[model samples]
Target: MLLRLPTSVSEAQQCLSEGAIPVGGATLQWAVWQRDGFPEQAMSLREVPEANVLSAEALGAAVPLHRVDDRVPEVLRRAAGGIGTGAVRRSATVGGNIVGSTLRCLLPAAVVLDARAVVLDVEGPFETDLAELTAKRPLLLSLRWRTPQASGYRKLAEAPGGPPPLVVATAVHAPEGARPRLRIAVRDGYEVLAESVECDTGVASVLDALAGTAIGALPAEAREVVREQVTELLARTAA
Candidate 1:
């Protein structure tokens, strides 16, 4: 049997307690179904949650739960691109992105912004970093993060439309009085995070330096052209 619950985690838990698997988003399940034709009892969060997953407020804002077919911003859509195809985006939940750490995941952005997620369980509401929690436990409810300065997200696709094989860098241009921050996530690959510098100077120089710095940190010797392109983009943006 399938069960649908309100967007609240308490409601979700109620279903889980009643022997439901608690499918926040159907991305994973749908993927299995599409590829392998697996059939199983499934619940949809699309309708019960009111078809919303995110909302912005004044630090006390509450977001409604959502289901499939709801539209979001281009940036958000891109951010949720970890799920890949169009069908997945429609049915996927932000909570699933938080849990799976899929391509173009939004949690990284939330992490960059120092956001917190309010997770409600049978106990009560608990707060934590959306990204950090993904590293520890699967998120039980929602995620929240503070706004960043200037934010930039770039993905290095393997082929033309393939998943990123290298790095998907998400940067938060530090607040007016703060230092710039960057998160370079390397997929199916590894990057050195031991030492790095934060620049608040001109954008061109930073991008140039980023390429060389990143290249220096890498182990593979495939090519050095990617660095050059990144440096060039930084230059153009700075210009």
Candidate 2:
């Protein structure tokens, strides 16, 4: 297949509008082509010069805009189970997933943190709510909130030979005086979805509810043996 990597969304869209299938990262497309039919032409946003990937300083400076990442939030030690394999996560990016609206990835984590996505095109820089940006527009950049607290992730796979029917992530934040923040993300039906819960809960408790919500939100046809799987995986990260 022919490959074209554009430096900016306008260029990428230009290629796509011209009939090329522009992909932010090739892995997701590879995942499809590997099991499905042959793809003719491909363009990537990774090699593009104008890609808005951020630096550590940039992540720090964005605090005023989002105000969530003000402290050193605990980095998640464990990730939800059944989210592809190690290789996939290693190469995958927050920007890539958000732009493509790749479900069950990490957008939910950002959403719960009240993160803002920084988007830019030939026009200029714009900020979008993480929840609506991915689904609505071409993602330019994802800026997660730097907050005080901890978070965890969980997921249930189909079986030893199958892919996951559900994935859940819970983010708990210790905002100064208000009730602890609980945010949950679920891998449901065709896309990944999320919701927020206001409570005085800990990270572990938040994850437990998130695990249930993740599975419960799934379509009935998609639920079954995985119920037990959810409990098992969630317990691993449960406090």
Among all windows of 10 consecutive residues in model 1, the one with the lowest summed lDDT is 57-66
lDDT of 1 by residue, 1-239 (tens): 44455555456556544545445456565666678764434433444342244544112112211331124322233455644676656655666655543443554345444556665444555776644565665334554444443344444555775544553333344557666654333333422121123644654555556557544456443224334433443454355
Q: List the residue pairs that clash in candidate 1.
A: 46-67, 51-66, 51-67, 52-65, 52-66, 82-103, 115-145, 116-144
Candidate 1: where is the Cα deviation over 4 Å? 7-9, 30-53, 56-77, 81-83, 101-104, 159-164, 180-184, 188-197, 202-216, 219-239
Relative to the true structure, candidate 2 reaches a TM of 0.57
Candidates' lDDT values, in order?
0.45, 0.51
Candidate 1 TM-score versus the reference: 0.62
Model 2 spans with C-alpha error above 4 angstroms: 1-22, 30-82, 101-104, 160-164, 191-193, 201-239
Q: Which residue pairs show collisions in model 2?
A: 7-48, 7-49, 68-146, 69-145, 69-146, 69-147, 70-146
- TM-score for all models, in order of appearance: 0.62, 0.57
